[model samples]
Target chain A: MILPPPEPQTRRQLLRGAAARTASAALAAAAAPGAGGVAPASAAVAVPAASATIDRLQRLVRVELLLEYCYRQVLSSTILRPDARRAIAPFEGHVEAHVAALEARLAARGATLPPGPASVSQANRFLARRRVGGRLGHLRGDQDALRLLLSMEQVVIGAHFVALLKLSEPALVELSAQIMATGAQHDAVLRLLLPPHKLGSAAPYGLVQGVQ
Target chain B: MVGDGGGASRRALLGAAAVAGLALSGCGATAAPASTRPAPAVAERDLALLLAALELERRTVAAYVAGLPLLPRALRGTVQQFLSEELEHTGELISLVRSVGGRVPARPNSFQLGHPSDAAGVLALVHELESAQIATYLSTIPQLSPGPVRAAVASILTVDAQHVSLIRLQQGQAPVPSAFVTGAE
Candidate 1:
């Protein structure tokens, strides 16, 4: 008999499955007594916590990849002015750096690296989940492009903020915060480059909670 | 016969409990002290870090107020906006500190904000102060327990980083010079 192809799995489904496995392992370890007839706290808490960190890291890597895809598209477009291009070229490099760091983290955790958007449809789906779909096609001019980029940066910042709340490891938390700060910088710079060029518009609020 | 079985099971349970107690004691002796332990619940370290952040914010507020007069007319509005936002940060941090049962330090009567003769000097000072604030938040975020407090500090750090970028732009320098904002100049 011939076998059918495996069904495609969403990122959320993969994460959920991993989390369930981790919890099951933790429970098993907790239920089985050790030589001392007791289960250590680490056995019950550490495994699940580490698994949670990995899950958050994986999610963030996906976010970074989406950003990389968006940045590459904008950089190749003719919508940006020469000056604007000069300023934004560095931002793409920044996204790449973020991806590299996050990828290394996932590798350390022995998790598979997630893929970025390989087509326009995939990119739109990513944006749609964030409630900002079809924005890529709306960049009719430099102003429109800058606005979209600003919104994307805010999304990145918010992603990191949410990840920080869930990450249990100190090093991962620090890394996420560092990356989030850079996203905010990108947002501020894009605001300055936008129309009505005012410094006040760059950082309108003290709290950088992002567009969410 | 039932009485005999019940006694035997009770003895086995007692033996297991004794073994568990010994294991716990051994683990406690090898582990770090309770004072330095990192718990999910709020601890003294969290309170201390919050207070430190609050102090830095208070100083920033004072610096902005004192340096406002030194800034050029064109830059005053932007600096004023930053000052207002900094004040808001101070308020949020104060509330956080209090929520965690920390003693809020009294604001200093005045900060010795260096005398900057021109807009350049004032901008430079503000840039330095903002960078330091970013550094404090970066260092504090990892140390803080995973919760709304850590998230709030990260949010503030991002805004401070943005301030540094804007200040650099006003200083005729490249904005966002680095991929990683590590709080380093």
Candidate 2:
């Protein structure tokens, strides 16, 4: 289940953290776990940097397909209004571009791209776990649809940024940043639509930008 | 959860980002107004990168802000909050550029792919903007040392994904269309 993020940190609480010694200690205390406790950094999915490029690409491809499926399902299903479909249509094209571009890049490296989202069948299984109701979920209304998209945006923003950091190719890193920037633009819109309580009380509630 | 020293701390970026994420859920009744700082001139290289990034962000902020107003009331919050997040990001970029001695341009380039109508127009704009943004970070990420600059870029890169989702969500599109998402540097 998608649990609510930890309680918003108070100004004094955050200041106390700044005085701490290390990233671990700070994150640990911040995420102390119970009522009013923060979820430690260790609890969040660590961006796995141990894998080979090919492996990373494979996993990313899976995520991309999954995201595409979620959007398509939400759009095509009875969830959103008919007028909203017009707005959602371009996203499919965007994904198609991402897929084609990645496939071409992979092909040049002699590594075949995994099948596009269309060819991926288990996408529903992957997304169902993430959907609000934990199934091939349906939005209760426009608000729910918007919220679902916002949640997905957090993940997307994290992915491209992660890709930029993890990828070995300098050029690819640049490309990932470009892809990432677009994601940023989309995210801004999602954020503006949210309510006061939902916006977390942190700098990047979406992803952890590893420090040097 | 940021402290009063939030403005002075490294974690300030982290604090505002939470608001960025929430601007969508109809949450965030009180976004502490960031103390305004005027944009100052930045280094040449830094300026280019910052402007590239800023222009891209401004375009997004404008698109959503402009679009949200056009959306029906039932769907108002989604687009509105999205724009607010962009505004927050715009603040980040503006401050960064100024701190680096760069000047943020007065106006952003277009997000429109020629005309305003048609799906292709929107997709083309998305493709162009996404490509440009990716290029902006790509060109800059390698040059930045393993420090704040790097951290900033990484942070912003992640925010990009949020933008991608809204673009996709609008047309019944997917959040991600491809499988290759990592760079093993």
Candidate 3:
């Protein structure tokens, strides 16, 4: 006789439970009559069109792949100091993990995972365009690599924020938020590495702003 | 909308409805069926989530205050920075709550945070608090109305996550201790 599949892992089960609790609390409050200052839990909220969401995820995947490649380049380049290379390794590993996680998510949904690094040519071109002055973007020194990484982290964070707003699935929203937080940490670490003259006070804003 | 009566029953009903809806939406699908009908003009659910989150931020700020004294002098600045960010988050949340005609809930002068003896204990408290906040924001975002407000919540969460990483790093742990930050419940 065929055996049944194993139960969901504890973490996944807990996430589902939390999502249930949150939904129950919010929906009940919405459904209640004349409840506090809450607006009526009127009609269903809108989510992004299914096609649009898929396309956005695909774009994010491509961007992340490009980031992984850049991180690899910086780590391998002789120009980077030994200490800097060591510092960047964990971050690079995180990017690789992000790409894998995102790919698995897409595959689970029956969506095509865009083929490896070549798919991010547009992102590469964009970074090329972003190169300060006439210097090569990806071939620069430690500070330049850090700047480049900072810019990329900002882009990823912004994309995740937009994705979080549009995604209807609690799991995906949670995933996006988690990655966005990691990206912010990476940005802060990189900023601290730069010279004080180049960087202003750390933690510059009370609220971190994303693309509108 | 906030409710004062029959909360348990209403929550049970809502929970059942949500489970049923999820079943119909399929395993991988994240949203309800597309409707040509216009979306709701007002976001009642978003407002409720914001109000709840605002209260959590207040508690978080208080926790930081309680933990600060226990932290080493070198790390005190870090906790202070986190406290400031939490306060800023509170200010923004207040605006969102007010925008939806919700009343600002009262914040007590002090929130009860367990006493921690040493630096490690203080860090542990902060780690636990940030993890809870991260989970709260993660779950709440999907239920929120899709717009700038949701984006703002996402941004705040990103910063909170950053704070957690900083704390972990200070304690000689990996800045990113997990591949996936949620699912911690």
Candidate 4:
């Protein structure tokens, strides 16, 4: 019997939920008209908007941390070929850099850093919440590992795309786009290393909304 | 005039309608009266950026057309595919510009892209053009308001960066040399 596919865990979903919550709160405020039906000043609106951006930034930090954990796991695995290992080792460093940049941003905002997965079991639990648990342990070959990494990179791209929509600060939006573009580069390179590697698969679409 | 014809036209129509609607609705927020509503300066700025990006995309498309024959037989297919994607980017940008009530700029009859002597020269020219495209999008993203327009620009930027990575791979260099795709390199 054909079974239904598990619901994919997407950062788009998380961001959408966050956006909905923010929208609902705004709507609630709007529904309750101020004295003489006058709208609130722009300064009053700015506070919540700034806090929402911070919340989104914090979520992205958690995502980067989890991704860093996953990258470390795959790098340590013996399933990858030596050449593949050499090519992909830099990606782990990239993810670490992403984490560092995001953490610095959070610290600048005086936001607490979200704790990352500290162990393999913790990482698996994190993945399981997204319905892709035991991913690190499932690697049978180089292709498997590469495919997993490709999917992860796509997730990063999607997350940043969603975050960009609500990010108020232009600098933060620019930083997010820069990071997202790096994820796309990683996606393309990983696709080239996969089976039946072709340039077409490396860049199959002009618009990258990511796996979501 | 610079894209895959019918598809680009249809997308342009849809984009125009969507942007007009967005403008009318004050970006999906509570609509105040026309006099009280603010001017669409943000949309105009986005339109300008999209138009500039569209112009660059058109030139990049032209460069691929001019340089395609100079590439090696094995590399032609890849470059051809990249050409098609560049056309797609133009179509998307055109749609965005139209949606924001901006005039679609006239496509240049020809670009003064430098002549490449051989396959290596062609690759170098393509790389230079792609890098410039990447840099343009990176700078443009921050200026765009936080919305679908910014999202769309980011999407296109990523693809351009991907093209660069593949080109580097073909040149036997590191596919992704940097963690951040600043496009300055």
Q: Which candidate is the best by DockQ?
A: 1
DockQ of each: 0.57, 0.14, 0.29, 0.56
Which candidate, 1 or 4, has the higher lDDT? Answer: 1
Which is the winner by DockQ between candidate 1 and candidate 2?
1
Where is the poorest 10-residue window by lDDT in model 4 chain A? A10-19
Q: What's the best-to-worst order under TM-score?
A: 1, 4, 3, 2
Name the best candidate (by lDDT). 1
lDDT of 4 at B101: 62
lDDT per residue as tens, model 3, A13-128:
44345545665666687677777535534422322354566776777777676677777766766867677667667888788788777766665544556644543355567555
**lDDT of candidate 4 over B108-140, digit per residue (tens):** 544566655556665787788899999999889
The number of residue pairs in model 2 that clash at the backbone is 81
Per-residue alpha-carbon lDDT of model 2 for A39-147, expressed as tens digits? 4466444324323555656555555556566667776677665555554556655654554555445444334345534532355455554452323453577557756
Q: Report the C-alpha lDDT of model 2 over B57-162, residue by residue, as the tens digit.
A: 6665444433332244544554455455556655666666667656555652233323323333333444445445544555677565333454456565554454
True contacts kept of each: 0.88, 0.25, 0.56, 0.86
Where is model 2 more than 4 Å wrong at Cα? A1-51, A115-121, A128-134, A190-212, B1-138, B145-151, B157-185
lDDT of 1 by residue, A1-212 (tens): 98899799964455546655665665676576673545567766776877787788878888888888888888888879999999889999899889878877766555667878888678878888887534676678888888878878888898898887788678888899999999999999999899788999889876887755
Give the whole-model CA lDDT for all candidates, comma-separated. 0.75, 0.49, 0.63, 0.73
Question: What TM-score is obtained by chain A of candidate 3?
Answer: 0.67
In model 1, the Cα lDDT at residue A115 comes to 75
Candidate 2 TM-score over all chains jointly: 0.45
